[model samples]
Target chain A: MQMLRKLSAGLLLLAVASFASTPAAEAAGQTLEIVKKRGHLKCGVSQGLPGFSTPDNRGNWTGIDVDFCKAVAAAIFNDADKVKFTPLSAKERFTAIQSGEVDIIARNTTWSMHRDTALGVDFPVVNYYDGQGFMVRADLGVRSARDLDGATLCTNQGTTTELNAADYFRSNGMQYEIVAFEKADESVAAYNSGRCDAYTTDHSALYAQKLKLSDPKAHIVLPEVISKEPLGPLVRQGDAAWNDLVRWTHYATVAAEEFGVTSKNISEMKSSSNPSIRRLMGQDGSFGDNLGLSKQWAVHIIRAVGNYGEIFERNVGVKTPLGIKRGVNALWTKGGLQYAPPIR
Target chain B: MQVLVLAAVLGAMAWLVGNVQSNLERQNINSGFGFLSERAGFGINQTLIAYTEDDSFGRVLAVGLLNTLLVSALGIFFATLLGFSLGVARLSRNWLISKIAMVYIEIFRNVPLLLQIMFWYFGVLRNLPSPRQAVSIGDAIFMSNRGFVVLWLEASAGAFWYGLAALGLVIGGIWLRRRAANAQITTGQATRVWRPLLGLAVALFGGAALMAGVPFALDVPHLKGFNFRGGLTVIPEFVALLLALSLYTAAFIAEIVRAGINSVSKGQREASAALGLPESVALRLVVIPQALRVIIPPLTSQYLNLTKNSSLAVAIAYPDIVSVLAGTTLSQVGQALEIIFITMMIYLSLSLLTSWAMNRYNQRMAFVGNNT
Candidate 1:
């Protein structure tokens, strides 16, 4: 009986110990604190989307999205390289963030009502504004999307592009068939191999994917924008501090652009008399400290990834293979929608 | 002591469930089956049922389930047919025939099913001519990279009566066969049943067709804008997925069949021969029934594997349950936990149904008690 009591006591202790660990596991949702403890930020990115997030031969990732994650890493660790990227598909991206498999999702995910309200993740800011469009072979003679009646379209499954095409065709009273593949490259290859009459996706993505086709010059993107796809970074919900940190990381780049602060001249401009510049450069009030970071958070972000304009130009601008233009993604000062609040 | 273990297990389950609930609540994520009624604002390329973008998520699940069932049922049918043939050929007297069967079994069974699916979809089907230059069979059927387009029969309202008439013919045939067997048992006089039944069936079907004014109209496919319209299209994804699934499962089924045939006692075959039966009749009457006892349980497992592997349809965009419901709908609704749980339940139900059917067949084939 004494030995039985000892055994029961041991079992009880084990149960109690497991119960005690639940709260610690619950606190794992505090993403910023966990990142600080782990020393490296886990950023979810695309499998391989050019001009967004694509790794090179040596596994070095480069894109506007990649730069955004680097900026976040710099803010937290003060080192741009302290980031581990988890490549995810469209179907897997939300689950990865919701399950806490990644600290942030820097993949090119569209911000939508259903996702914002229903998904367990929060889209803090729009990094790139994209729109759905169609690309058809040059020989098809289909000038407008309206002429695509009775056509077969290829696109990636589990994306807004599929729904957008369906809605666009249905509302226009035009009958069309969609052949969606799980991977973006499969859809592009299908379109290239003449399995589909056209390929539809984000306009910017169409340009990037066209380069991978057998004859890149043979396809033309239709001059039609179907849906508003404000692609942005996402973080798990229930952590307002982490949400603010990610939101401000994006705004910091835009504000730096508005203040005419490039990575090359940011250090020299620190001595400027401009009040906005002084506040943004961390020469004024403790803005970063309020978010539990050093006062020079914005400085680290800008120095690591440059302003938004520089990141865009270096990765997907006019000189790049994608050659995307900053139409609505430009700063509000230049007649665009990108506007940032005052740092102070 | 057993009660204590059971209580501990139940308590652990309760804790896990509570943990998930609290976590989801904390994140403000909606968790329930309510999202199933919401609109599924997406289009599936291939659907066995009438589906549109305006359909609810519930309808999408139905469409996906039907597609999965279609592929799995057809895959099983073809795999069984090919597997039995190859198993027999493997035991052929001719050396080249047996070697050919061996080669086929080795080549297909050793390679991954996913690679085979990709090979058929990308390497073979995609290389077919474009729709503009599609190979046409008198214009009623076309083969192209897009898919195989065939002229199909469009049934009018009268087709229902014709279908009922066919069902009646089947029932009549079964009754006639049973009566013939009874006659042979009681009076020792054989009765010819099939010829009369065949004649009656033809007459009944013809009369029904005449009364229903021939209910089927030929729907021919023609090149419209970019695709063939007004006909049945066998999309390449389905064809590729079906081919890969059948060929891969057929290889394993062939081995199962071979082992079953070998397990039948040599004495059974010799006894049927001593009764002056032909080799084919002896094999079918004496050997097969006994071999089936060994073949069934493993064959059931192979069927389950084939059904589960159909989930790989997503890789080739076949619009099966995993692709349509779990991939697109879950992503759109952002209800991962609920959607995944539902999908798991669906697969479990399908597997259980398959196992139950196979067990019924096995019971019917088993020998009647100790008489053996």
Candidate 2:
């Protein structure tokens, strides 16, 4: 009995001591420095979302969100090759970031008020401003989300779109039942199987799903924008410098677009007398130093992937086969919300 | 020396983790269980226990744990009953009877559980017609893509009074059995087991209704515009999870049951027959008692595995522990360490408790067999 008591006491003491030291350990910041020494930025992304993040036949990742991941790598190491992308599911996305398994999440996740205030993570700057919409067979004659009042909605699990749906239904005084699937693939399959009345998700994703249908022209996304879904990259709570470096990597692309810079002409513009261009490229100033990076960090980003317009136009926008227009994602100067802070 | 070596290794691991934590903290990234107390701002796909998006991580974990228990218990109860019955049928001497049982086991046992769960959840259950085209069993009961909602009787206060009176009669019957059993030993008067069995059944239900002054009331389900009103509703996710688990585990149980029966000696059956026992009574009162000793241990483990595999509820977003705490709440609060550790501990406790209870029951069964 005494021996058992002693053993249990030892275990209890170990548990309590470990529990007691957590905050003290968290107060010190050595892991971020450890990551810097490791050289590669670990970014978690989706496995397959077509234009956002998907693996090619060669196993190399290529998409708009993927390019942003490499851009952060360039901002940090002046080499876009230093990023390692981790493919995560909707269910695994949060835990991967929360457990420090991945340093940052570039999955097309929405920034909700509850997630921001409660999730111990921060989503800064909307990379893609999407809205919740419904996609249905064109023959169904569904022209609006409001028409989905009594329609069965097929949606993926563990998403803000689920709650946004409930709010939309309640406020509109519409009655509809949800048919939720854990994976997006299952929802798509069920929708195709004629199990649901319509599929609901972000407008961009609805377009993607529509294109994957047996006959792409047979389906159309309804015109109603029900909720504001600002999809962006997220970093863990704390670590201001790393967050700024990541957040600015996204901003640098927009800033580059605004300066009329393209990857094709950036090399020649290095000697241009444009003051904002000089500051952005870090050719004339200490903007890079403030972010704890190299003077040519922006230049390296442009060389490896080009500006935001090149990245989007090559993958998801009108230039590519997805054929999505640059509606709300255009540069602020072009009358949209893609605004970047002035480096001055 | 080995103990000291292991302790040294454990200490080194702790030191390494501590070093990494301090380094991460200096870079201003928070760590540890502080995140668990934060609010869970996301909604789950299906929740059995009540919850809101605003509920704390602790409450969410509780909901997940409840869902895990609900499904696993139901799976174990049904699988064991079906498995043991089929297992006996497999060992039957009749050619046609045994052949059918062999085919049933082979077909179900060979398929992977995950494929079955996916097949039921996505392919089969989702194919059901919409609520608007609900399939009613009779005019009084309704079933459809919405779900089956049937009429149920609710016991009221006056129903309890009559129930207790019936229970008292059952107790009187059981008392008569004890007296008769003692008389059978002393004066050679046999007592019927059915008398006490029937009495116990009457006591349980009658006592509930009669002593509590509860009356019986019927609750009839009604269908409204798009859904059923005033009846218990089971979701497709739950139906799929239950069907897949029960079918997967039952095939294994049947084999264990067959093995237990085969392990029994022919001498036992012959001895019972020589004592003038009928075939049905020889198999039940003689053969099964001995076979139970062989059947129980592996049967218990199968039940435990079924329980643990229910954690795959995460795959279907069944609001089980893995999906709610490890999947949703962990992301909501970033409390990865605390939530996962607590979940593992709970599962470990559940399995251990089950094993302990099974061990106790097996001991009692074994002791009785040995004496016989």
Candidate 3:
């Protein structure tokens, strides 16, 4: 009996070793397939950026970036709620996506050339157009960013804002000290507590974080927008189908809005005669097929999160506490920069 | 059978690495050290060496290394001083001093180091009055939310000669100490070395200052338009990091120190007392040397802990190595594997070097054969 048990234990060890030696190449090109097999989409998001991705007391995530991931889930599973959110920090977001800890990263990550070519990830579309800006206390007599000479600024570490703030200050011949914190709220707390003369970030985030101050009305964002920050959702490289699916999910929402298709009226508007709307709604084309998604992908997405305008208005529009206007994020028809190509 | 098992483990590891390498190549993420030379476009808040946004990543890494070393060395020095005092105080006969030291160790060591860091940074330092309302320390130091600004001495060309004079005085002090010890050993008479040492310091430094025309001029920080204009500035983040690291590490070191001192047998002290040596001399000569043997190995570990814990400076944005280089550079270059590997290796080597030095010291303190 002892001999038999030893032989069985040796066989079990050999089996475990064989399983461990399986190569990673087989897992490289099938993010979509794996996510499908896993029965849900794993979405990477910020830990808590108020208007972008914040969790409620009930632990339900609600934000524009959260809406984007929900839309992607609806496109895949026809159930917007069939997605889990992994709250990642600025330092861990890219690695989370790279390691396949999450299938897609819908964090408000800026689309930069260096990240695109270097990080082995592809940013599908620019969901929000933002620029770096500064906010100072009204009592500081600092009217513009140029008046920010010798200012100590507080910002989150491991972000583009740090480099942008450095560049803007150096070029403008201002000597500034930046006190960076690991989390966004920590930096804001430092700024709110008077540890710094000013706080800087993407202009939209500045507005979102300003509301968190003790006296929100006491700080004014500076006028100068330093760098172009085109924030978007991204996926790992080497998966073209997965990349295309994410890209088209963003485009579908924009196209639905341009065609005057709201989630409330999407079912009723299905009978409309505009062929562009028809193709976008997946009414009469192989568009979703080409992207390897079901034909009703656009309908599911629009139904889940409404059009792009709806998501923006609900989370961060002028009516909301964030009060961010869709200046450059509006549709091209409305003289904004958001323009998507025809589905056909 | 053992060799076969080891071979199997190594073979499995090799296969896994080969698989990962192939996957990384397929995914087009470049893996190498060549990218270390690329321009690091980020700026660090505190730099010991000259660094700009235009400097290469390698230089930034160098700056980070210097910062890490500065904080660690400073932390080790301060922690040791503070720990030794607390340890001695813990054994004090006075009820108040001993209890106070006990309370201090319990409070600092029991609470998380990270929380203490945040409390010092966000709760204490950040809430200080603004720069314009900075609190003054006499006329040489200023404290505010902006930073700790102190009057710095600007040495002119003649200051180099003064530095030489100071060096000579230090050498003279050491020589006088050795001579006094030799005299006591030979003549069985204790010589008072303090007077000569103090006189030599005062005369040498005073003469150097007069000859060099009072070379150092104090540059006090003055209020500028929005902030302080020009003294040596210690940013609040750095202050908080230093304060938190030293205090927290000191608590652990105190416990180690108390244990070490307690490890010296009571018989030794009693024997020294019987030999008619003073209590102070018994502690300084007989007790401490023996206690240090027990103290140093664990004390070395504490020093290493403080160095490693310095990485938490990232939480408060002090721009230590883990913060500036590993955090920012890894994100920018997209060389997570390479950057993380290199960072781990750097820390590994740092700990190894520290252990090696401490071990050498330990060996020196160790009792020789038949000495015990």
Model-by-model lDDT, in order?
0.89, 0.76, 0.87
Per-residue lDDT tens digits of candidate 1, residues A1-344?
75685577558657755764554364455778879999999999999999999999999999989999999999988899999999999999988888778889998999998889888778999999999999999888999999999999999988988899999999999999888888998888888988899999998899889989999998899999999999999987778889999999999999999989999999898998999999998899999998889999999999999999999999899999999889999899888889998887
Itemize residue pairs with steric clashes in candidate 1.
none
Best by DockQ: 1
Ranking by lDDT: 1, 3, 2
Instruction: Give the winner by DockQ: 1 or 2.
Output: 1
Per residue, candidate 2 scores C-alpha lDDT tens digits across A1-344 of: 65665566567557756755654443333334645788888899986777888788888898888998888887777788888999987767876765577778988999887666555567876889889988887877677777766666778776777767767886797767666566787778767765567888888888776766767787787888889999999877666776787788888888888888888998888988999999988889888888777888888888788999888888798766588898899988888889999878
Considering only chain B, report the TM-score of each candidate against the true chain B. Answer: 0.96, 0.83, 0.90
Worst 10 residues of 1 chain B by lDDT: B363-372
Native A-B interface contacts kept, per candidate: 0.73, 0.18, 0.56
Cα lDDT of model 3 by residue, A1-344, tens digit:
65665565567567655654342433367777787888999999998888899999999999999999999999999999999999988888888877767888988899998888877789988889999999999999989899988888899877899889989999989898877777998899889988888999999899999988999999999988999999999988888888888988999999999989999999988888999988887789888888778898999999999999999999999999999889999899998999988888
Number of the top-ranking candidate, with lDDT as the measure: 1
lDDT score of residue B183 within candidate 1: 96
Better of 1 and 2 by lDDT: 1
DockQ per candidate: 0.56, 0.24, 0.52
Q: Model 3's CAPRI class?
A: medium
Candidate 1 structure quality by residue, lDDT tens digits, B1-372: 656656766676676677777777777888989989999989998888898999999999999999999999999999998988898888788999999999999999999999999999999999999888999999888999989999999999999888988898999999999999999999999899989898978888888888898799999998888888988999999999999999999999889989988887777778788999999998787777787888889999989999999999998888999999899998898889889999999999999999999999999888632214
The CA lDDT at B21 in model 3 is 71
